[model samples]
Each structure stands twice: as structure tokens, then as C-alpha cells.
Target: MSRGYNGTEYFRNAPGLLSVRLKTRLMWDGRLDGADLPTAVRDMVTEAHFMNADGRLIQERIRQIPELLALWREAFGAQSQPYGPQIFVAIAEFLKTLDGGDTWWTAPCAATR
Candidate 1:
């Protein structure tokens, strides 16, 4: 069932990640309730056609970075450091900052006035 990277309509605009938080479901089929960003990030990383990476593997790799480990500790106060779920949380938080610049498409048009 893996779609395998086709480089065709595979990626969405990064800024759209912010808007997805308002969605009731995640993924194209809209099966995931609440569209939870952490859950979506975890699924994307582990899904075969996407990152295809094990959560444990990602955690191990991230732990090797001293700066990131420190930031994780400061952010979450985790004594053990770099908990697997923290990675997803961090990614979700970062995506929240991707609010796209205000453009005509995002502005209120005269029709609404």
C-alpha cells in the first residue's frame, strides 16, 4: 500500500502545516480524528512510503546532538533527555511557526465587506 516517492503532488506547502491544525482529521482520506500534529508527525516518519524510519532510530540519532538534547531538556524538563515523543512534539511546535505571510489569498476580500 506504500505510495513510494513519486515526486508528483507529494509535498504540500510547508506553511499549510499551520492551517492543518484547524482540521478535524489528518491525511488525504481524513481518517485520523482531530488532525493531531504530533500523531501526524509520528505517522509520517514511520510510514513506509515517507520517512520509513523507526521512531527509536530517530530518537537515537537526535540524542547524539548535544545542543538539541539540551534544548529538549530545557523545553520539557526531561531528565532522561530526548524522549521519542519529544521529537514529534518539537516538530509540531516548529510547524506552528510556519504561518504563511499575509497575502491576498489570506486577506479578507471585498465580498465579505
Candidate 2:
């Protein structure tokens, strides 16, 4: 006989709750694909991933946390003293000035274009 509504089944567990205790961790050996940002910056990004991560960083399964690019944008965007907004305005104007609206330029450094 089954105690049908006793709710003692593992299969009836709450969604996303089962994986909640399974922490995801991240580990990196510090490799950089681009020459512009420097090793330190790249390493900082990787370290941030681990530092901001939970104990399960080795599993590398965190939610949508910001990546390096997003981090840069957010960090820069939040700055005051007119530098960030000034540069932002200049870039917006510059992008508007583009003829083709696209360029095959290396990011974080436009000189490579």
C-alpha cells in the first residue's frame, strides 16, 4: 500500500533546489589570449571569478555573473569626475562618425585597426 500524498519521494523534490547545495567552483591557470590587457588584468579576472564564487568554484557553475568585459564596462561606467562619461561621449560620437558602422579592430585598443 502507498501513502500517496506523504511527499517523501526524492523525485518530487523542488526544482533548482537539488542543485542549490551543489556549489560550483572555478579554477584557472592564468592564460591570456590578448596582448593588450596584460597578464595581471587577465589573472585578476580569473581570480575574481573564483573570489566571487562559492566553495564549488571547481564545478564552475555559477549564475550569470559579469565577465571581464562586462566588469570593465560597469567599472568604467560608474566612474565620475567626467573621465568615464567624457570618454563615453567621445566614443559614442566616434561610433556615429563611422562610415561602415563596423571595424575589424582589436578591442580595448583601437590602434590595431
Q: Give lDDT tens digits, candidate 1, residues 1-91.
A: 3344444344443224655555777777776775478888888788765677877998888788888788778887878667678789888
Would you estimate the TM-scores of all the predictions?
A: 0.69, 0.18
How many collisions per candidate? 0, 8
Clashing pairs in 1: none
User: Stretches of candidate 1 above 4 Å error?
Assistant: 1-15, 101-113
lDDT of 1: 0.71
Candidate 2 lDDT, 12-113, residue by residue in tens? 222221222122321132243322222222232334332232223422321134463354456456432223233334433443343432346525677766
lDDT of each: 0.71, 0.32
Q: What is the lDDT of candidate 2?
A: 0.32
